[model samples]
Target: MMKSSATHYGSIAQFFHWCTAILVLVAFMYGPGGPEHRVYSPVHEFDRRLHETLGLSVCALTFVRLLWRTIYTRPEVPPASRLMVAMATAVQWMLYLLLLALPMTAVIGAWLEGHSVTLVAGWEIPPLFATSHDVGGAIASIHKWLGDAIMWLAGLHAFAALFHHVILKDEVLITMLPSWLTMGRARTGR
Candidate 1:
């Protein structure tokens, strides 16, 4: 019999999922410590560029992932309590929205700051708006807070996945685990 839903996400989805996670973690670690300690120096500039590059990469990956999701069905996770399912669905959608909004905000902020955004290998993305320090600062603040929210959401997501895997002994978490890591038993029919 044919499966009703995917057993595990394909390689491309898994790749983007893990890569985005790592990039987000790195971005958080590199962001300004606090408002009082904000300093514009060479090192800070380098970090900002790196952060921008990663953010752009994330935006590209998110677009591709969204397109893929539109074309393909997601794997079916085992049933959970209604409350748990609803919460998980909400979190998932929020993550998706963040993935879309965060990078666009960063790009807009960069343009407002009179900085050119260079993609990997030095390809420049033309600015979409005129330079405005005040606007840039405001967008920067929003970007930072959104990033902080993502970090908290990621923690919650990881905790919930672990709970389903370890505490509930459900396939919810395993279904997303890479096949090699899960010893090829992660798949569930439909």
Candidate 2:
């Protein structure tokens, strides 16, 4: 089914989830890390443009996913400790927040630095804000930190899901797995 059932997220939700994850990972890999000069250098142009494009895509997808959540009912997770539930919620929100903030910071920082956001096909989005090198540099620094933070947090998120599947022996992970990946197992979960 395309729509989510009480037992599991729909195909659409799973698609959004996995696609966002892949994009985030790829963008992170393409990120031109190091000093601003090195990052903005012609040597890294393609990588930077691809990274920014992927970041923008992630931002757009995340917004749509949030909107989808409002209209679609999510699967009901199995019972867990209140603390565990709260932790899960916190991590989820943090991931969403990073998904939005990373791109925003990248664009704003580039704009502040008097640079345009370059995309594929040589498309460019010019900076809207007045140049403020110092402030922009600071924001860029934060963006780098956030980039690192997301990787670590995503690692934690995956670890938690695996814990639920292996240690807890629950349906938490299976509920989100694609049907093909589930190998025709009962939808009711293992």
Candidate 3:
């Protein structure tokens, strides 16, 4: 049995990473399947609320994840092409930015429209801007576009990770897996 040199991310980091990933995917898919996609009621307000709630959750999780990264040492890198490394780094930071910005802009837009931003029956965040439908609409537009951009970037990240795992035969993907899983795989000669 061989020891795993794959340094998995801390449990907290991994949890946040996967949680956010799933939530983001759900939000994206739910957007298109709105009221128009269903034969039942003309619209699914439930799905829209779910998407908004999850989007806000992502924002909160991202804040904690960023703080955790600042305090902890990230995994060491396996050697790769400079271009690949650079592209990966760029995608990572961009993901962080989009994750934080999307929810924030939504919240701001809501505020400008005189709507309270609430988290799943929790307390509401008070409006921070003057009521203005025009302003809210513009900000919401930016938020939507940014969400789409993040979705594309996430797809690229997944593809790149798979490429490293299958084609490059590197530790890139394993390093982000749970520690126990990575260790078990190494012991099994994977």
All-Cα superposition RMSD per candidate: 3.9, 1.6, 4.3
- Per residue, candidate 2 scores C-alpha lDDT tens digits across 1-190 of 7889998889999999999999999999999999889999999999999999999999999999999999999999689999999999999999999999999999999999999999977899999979999999999999999999999999999999999989998889988998788876667445
Quote the positional error of residue 185 for candidate 3 in Å: 2.8
What overall lDDT goes with each candidate model? 0.75, 0.94, 0.77
Consecutive 10-residue window with the lowest summed lDDT within model 1: 32-41
TM-score of every model versus the real structure: 0.84, 0.97, 0.84
Q: Rank the candidates by lDDT, best first.
A: 2, 3, 1
Q: What is the Cα-based lDDT of residue 8 in candidate 1?
A: 71
Model 3 clash pairs are 35-43
TM for candidate 2 is 0.97
Error of 1 at 33 (Å): 5.8
Which candidate gets the maximum lDDT versus the true structure?
Answer: 2
Compose the digit string of candidate 1's lDDT tens values, residues 62-133.
888778778777888567789988999999989988887888877787678776775546577777767897
lDDT of 3 by residue, 9-80 (tens): 767777878898999998777653312225113365555566678888899899998888887777777787
- Candidate that beats the other on TM-score, 2 or 3, i.e. the better one: 2
Lowest-sum lDDT 10-residue window in model 2: 181-190
Model 3 sits at a Cα RMSD from the real structure of 4.3
